[model samples]
Target chain A: MSQMEIKNITKKFADVTALDNVTLKLEENKIYGLLGRNGAGKTTLLNLITNRIFPTDGEILVDGESVIENDSALSKLYFMTENNYYPEHMTVKKAFTWTKGFYTDFDIEYASELCEKFSLKLSQKIKTLSTGYTSIFKMILALSCNVPFVLLDEPVLGLDANHRDLFYKELLKNYSEKPKTIIISTHLIEEAAEIIEDVIIIKSGKLILKESVESVLSQGYAITGSISAVDSFTAGKNVLGADTIGGLKSAYILGHLDKSGIPEGLEVTKPDLQKLFIHMTNR
Target chain B: MSQMEIKNITKKFADVTALDNVTLKLEENKIYGLLGRNGAGKTTLLNLITNRIFPTDGEILVDGESVIENDSALSKLYFMTENNYYPEHMTVKKAFTWTKGFYTDFDIEYASELCEKFSLKLSQKIKTLSTGYTSIFKMILALSCNVPFVLLDEPVLGLDANHRDLFYKELLKNYSEKPKTIIISTHLIEEAAEIIEDVIIIKSGKLILKESVESVLSQGYAITGSISAVDSFTAGKNVLGADTIGGLKSAYILGHLDKSGIPEGLEVTKPDLQKLFIHMTNR
Candidate 1:
């Protein structure tokens, strides 16, 4: 059974249509990348799924039941946003206690362990932690919540390289131990490409493409060679983007070409997620 | 002559030595990555150079003279921080006009063009712009300033994919037309690696490595093959990191190996800047 399903969902704010006839089915035990440019309605779709906002039209079902204002259904999901709201004068320990009451699966022991790993001070007030620390605190809550579905929107905003790598490793470890559905909305595509099993690309409030990560990347190839050779080879192909400097040229093509057809001294490589996204969206 | 020079720079905050006798030279017409883990004193160093704060020991020379309180030398540099402090009543156009007085090379026409390209309203007050637009406003100032030295500390913090790509392309175009000494401090290493000519890695408030980009990546290689073949090849080698799935293994090894020595059915590639930075700092 699908963990979450949105059928013909549409959300409008006055003259702005944030989402238009968006239909998506999220499976269980997989990592999905929710990607798009700014103002592409990725956040709107996520908010609708989490019931933070209601859809203007159509229906959303969680476990085959309407989710609007449904406590039992909402309890099965955890949604973490870029900006977290914490009450004033609340210490880390108090926040943990508060979340424990709301989430039955909240593991205080695991949360405490994560705090220690991230070197967070349990006694410090929520407002006293640095931006990166605040993110860690929220991540701890999300991970220990142990919900069937978790949604993270730009979770690594303020983290450094080491901390980001650590977060990814911990996420994978937790997933292996307790399989669940994860939807991550982020701009750092290449970094998360390996972990994401599927991808959903949104553009201008419309769903552009939704497919497995492997299938998405397999549709494009990057070719580099002399300017003349590259220009000739890319003549009739669907060129996503091209960069040229002096006599060297590199073009991202929509379809793969046979190895024998590529010119000598030219380099043909697989397109990274970032390159593909840039090419696809820019076009 | 160097655009900026740091001689025996040391900063101490009570018992903490934030920067430890660091000395470096920044030449003109190059982009340098001022990279390090959090609390590595990158912000402190930039503050010292910009004369916003004084160093505990040593000196910063701009154009062969100390820049402390010297308006003539300081006006040649522009530093864009995470938070821009413009009066709430100030409009975008007014901010541009005010910046013209501080920067001798400020170009109003160019600023207007960028404002349009970023879809910014000139009449909108600074407080009315969204977080992403605020960043774009600051970026416009930095680019249009045409200063000899530009320093950006996490300038692309909240930007989405399309805007970030636009920023990179604009930065490169500006650099190619008007070369300057630019230092960007960011956690997104791989995104910036292609644009930066030099890299400076810092750790624990100490300089770890500073070299050309090619030289840094030349020391590490990534090898992928069958689990057994990968394990045997990486044996006795400095394995910075490794990822395994089923029978396939990918190992990041220190030091380069001859192409002929690579095992059959194995793929050897260069390590990405982000991965390399994480491995280096974690170790």
Candidate 2:
């Protein structure tokens, strides 16, 4: 029953505000989708939590205890970053050994198993691995650390289709066996939609929405029909966006749908997460 | 109509073969999805076409002429490579001027227009942009070059969902206005599936698939039902793969499916591009 709380956090880098009066409570044993556009402060927020940088104002607490240079509280978290963690000449085996010092529950056997599954050789130097393999290596470290809170940033950055599928399945399997609070920030919204339970969306360094995936998805829908029919149906509603092809049209609406009020030729379907994200952050 | 032919191409690096004997014909004015896993020789093929790398044993011809050390033949092509084209500290405007020297049809006005649309400042240094902006810069160059053959490598690497959508729309519009041969090498299959006219899948330095998207997608299907029912229906058939969850099962088939022959309680769906790709290249 662990929980992390950010109380009115504000981060500023010189004149630019990276995060503005953002507050959120993250509970344990759940997967979160941290979504935002590039330079929207997703990475900045993550950095603040991991003590890589200090917020201009605010208090962060884990289980009611502050997480400022407090090794015990910080030990529960693992951040899988984009930058290389190990030196160029260090082998995967050596990096595993180095990680064991920081992570109390680091599982070397599980790491070896993952390497075998991914066909990554432990003897190979960190710099020799391809982009996809580098991502795999980082993912292995994050999953094998056995930490309570895991932050994955663009985990599938260079992975192919099969590897991506494998990574998702493995992540789910690991979560099911040992439930932990996981946060994944990625641009591949559609692929990671099903894996995420709750979503936390930010725009321009400001918290916009935080809700369960089901509730968010249920609130928005797209209607396709003749231009006139589609326009009439969405005219007064909270229209998100619209696209037209000749006399046909599809309009995205963010509100309750009256099932019986639909026009004869109109077809309604749930809008995908990407469409919703684009519309929400476009401004 | 312009056409490029890769005839019996074979590339070797010291002791290892980078690309096996491969032959294919690429027609003009079509978008080709060049897909493969890492180290699958996709980049090798592109380099060979650009005459940046030589084939160990084969000939490449564009418009019935050799492309080896031929400036006139190479002038018709523009390669948006992963390596930085401009030296460090070079501005976007300066790079455009340098490109105009090589690419005869490089349109400075169109490049400026694209920079405005993509929100890329012409005066900004190439090295100072973020990952996403770097991608946008390259995409603008590829689209504005007006080359007969444009090869784009991971064009949407760091783009957000909104930017990715904009880039795809812009690409389609550009292609429609001026028809040319465009080959995109990317790992994001599902998003680009609809935009591609044909798919070229390479695996382990060999050409495994070369077919129109329509034919390849139409050939595969998935059936879901009870485990026993699915097994019975797919037994001894051209089954690609299957997944089972308790008593329920879904099997992917590679050949034509008899709709009427499907079991009474079974459901069917067209298999997506990734599923087919995973099954084809897993070995």
* Candidate closest to the true structure, highest DockQ: 2
Please identify model 1 stretches exceeding 4 Å from their true place. Answer: A222-269, B222-269
Candidate 2: segments with Cα more than 4 A from true spot: A224-236, A244-249, A263-267, B225-232, B244-249, B264-267
lDDT of 1 by residue, A7-112 (tens): 9999999999999999888899999999998788999988998899999998899899878999988999998886667898999999999998999789899889
lDDT (Cα, tens digit) per residue for candidate 2, span A193-232: 9799999999999999899988889998999999988988
- Put down candidate 2 lDDT per residue, B1-283, tens digits, no spaces: 7899999999999998989999999999999999898788999999999999999999999998999999888988999999886899999999898888877688999899989888899999999988889999998989988989999999999999989988998899899999999999998888889799999999999998899988888988999999988989988898878877779998888887778888799999997898888777775
How far in Å is the alpha carbon of B247 misplaced in model 1? Answer: 12
How many backbone clashes does every candidate have? 0, 0
- The DockQ values of the predictions, listed in order, are 0.67, 0.80
Question: Largest TM-score belongs to which candidate?
Answer: 2
C-alpha displacement of B102 in model 1, angstroms?
1.0
State the fraction of real interface contacts model 1 keeps: 0.80
